[model samples]
Target: DQQVKQNSPSLSVQEGRISILNCDYTNSMFDYFLWYKKYPAEGPTFLISISSIKDKNEDGRFTVFLNKSAKHLSLHIVPSQPGDSAVYFCAASRGGGGSQGNLIFGKGTKLSVKP
Candidate 1:
């Protein structure tokens, strides 16, 4: 079973518009949530994170909101640009303070921006 799921495989948006991506999880034990953005042939880079204790986290043009009760999360990008096009992955981990932070990731959502 997929612990994390990104139902939409792809999304397209115009430049300067807002882009939203959704994610869901099945595991209730997961305590830490993270979002990563990746380009082709390269590893994912950490974008933002939110602990189960909080509901929202933001960074500049990117914002992530989590609903622990619903086991769902979302990422929003404002004024989307062509450079923002990439695969976004939602990840979750059990927060026991482990080494390297092992994560279970969703299949990934590819975002396309038209300039």
Candidate 2:
């Protein structure tokens, strides 16, 4: 049973455009979140993260927002570049209460930024 779901499997955007990726979760107990970007032959790289205590987090061209009431989250990339093309995965975990913080991941949405 998948706890996280990325509704769209792919997204295409032109260079310098904005790319948005979405994800939904079944569990309401998840407290921590993360996003990872993966290239074809490389491992997923850490991108950005947010905690349930905060509604949003931003770094450079990447932004992540969490909607606790909806059990949903989204990643936004502005000024998209060709090098930004990758599979983006949304992940979450329970942060406290003696938990080890195991992350649940979405299938990922492949983003293609065309130049």
Candidate 3:
């Protein structure tokens, strides 16, 4: 069974609108959560992250919120732009003693922002 899941395979939003991507995890051991954005033909790049210690983290136009009790997380991109169009992957790790890059990722949700 997949530890992390992105139920929505795709999302579409208009430019200047808010885009929200959702993710869920089955593993309670996950303490670190991250979101990655991938453009066509390019490797996924880290977008935002939130630690279990905090319920939310924000940076610029992007924000990540985590709900430990529900094992859920979400990524929000405000005023979405065409440049924001890409596949977003949700990832989680147990952290602490885990080796580097030891993360479980979701299948990814392709986001298309239209002007």
Candidate 4:
């Protein structure tokens, strides 16, 4: 069963535009959330993250919003650049002391930033 899901398989955006990616989860135990960007034939690299306690978090052009009530989250990238085009994955982990923090990942959303 998929604990996390990305309903949109792909998203297309113009360079210098905003790219919004969405994710949903059924497990309430997830306390920590993260977004990862992946390139072809490579491992996913950490992008952004938000704790359940925060409604929103931002860094530079990347922003992550968490709505615990709805078990939903989204990633927003402002002024999306061509280099930003990649597959984005939504991941969650149950955080606690001594926890390995295994991440449960969504299928992923392929983002295309057109110039």
Candidate 5:
């Protein structure tokens, strides 16, 4: 089964702290990993992504680490701000070979940042 899983349903952190979200996958064929962030009543926005070929990818205050051998991935946000409060989804899919962008997303982890 091609399934993506986010073990934690939610997380809470104070401003200026670090927040981590974890995810797991069972499909060995997946080659691309992505993290999307969503706000209430809004669609998810692409945050960052890492190719299966790489171990890590970073963008601004966000970082993603992928462990292909372990079929696991994580998203880390540092100095979490009040604006960072939102739901985060972990997704995966097969690489560019005619593969439509139909992402398999986890239920999502809601991150709440306290001011």
Candidate 6:
């Protein structure tokens, strides 16, 4: 089973600035990594993901980066706004032989974008 770790419990960013959330994993065999954002009483929404074959992937204001050797990944949001405040979780899956066919999630980092 793949385990994801997000050491930072919370992050504060000023509006118009950048927010950087990090994630680390114990499994080197993880073939896929994803970032999800969650709001109160709402299900987590997929943000971005990166494959083992690629070091980075970007979509709109979000970007995901993967460092295979270190088994670490990060999500970056530029021009952070108040609406961007939410809990962000990092997930990983080994995806093939030993996978549980589900994503393993980190503890989640709460982001607060102050105006």
Which has the greatest lDDT? 4
Shift of residue 52 alpha carbon in model 1, Å: 0.7
The sequence of per-residue lDDT tens digits that candidate 4 reaches over residues 9-102 is 9999999999999999999999999999999999999999999999999999999999999999999999899999999999999976565478
Q: Write the per-residue lDDT of candidate 1 for residues 1-115, one digit (tens) a residue.
A: 8889999999999999999999999989888999999999999999999999999999999999999999999999998999999999999998666743679999999999999
Candidate-wise lDDT, in order: 0.94, 0.94, 0.95, 0.96, 0.92, 0.91
Give one digit per residue, the lDDT tens place, for model 2 in 44-82. 999999989999999999999999999999999999999
TM-score: which is higher, 2 or 6?
2
lDDT of 5 by residue, 28-70 (tens): 8888899999999999999999998899999999999999889
RMSD for each model, in Å, please? 1.7, 1.4, 1.4, 1.4, 1.6, 1.7
Flag regions of model 3 displaced more than 4 Å. Answer: 98-101
Worst 10 residues of 4 by lDDT: 93-102
**How does model 5 score by TM-score?**
0.93
Q: Considering lDDT, which of the candidate structures 1 and 5 is the better prediction for this target?
A: 1
Write down the TM-score of every candidate. Answer: 0.94, 0.94, 0.95, 0.95, 0.93, 0.94
Q: Return the clash pairs for model 5, or none.
A: none
Candidate 1 whole-model C-alpha lDDT, 0 to 1 = 0.94
Clashing pairs in 3: none
What RMSD value applies to candidate 6?
A: 1.7
Winner by TM-score: 3
TM-score of 3: 0.95
Better of 5 and 6 by lDDT: 5
lDDT digits (tens) for residues 7-96 of candidate 3: 999999999999999999999988999999999999999999999999999999999999999999999999899999999999999866
lDDT measured at residue 90 in model 3 versus the true structure, 0 to 100? 100
Itemize residue pairs with steric clashes in candidate 1: none
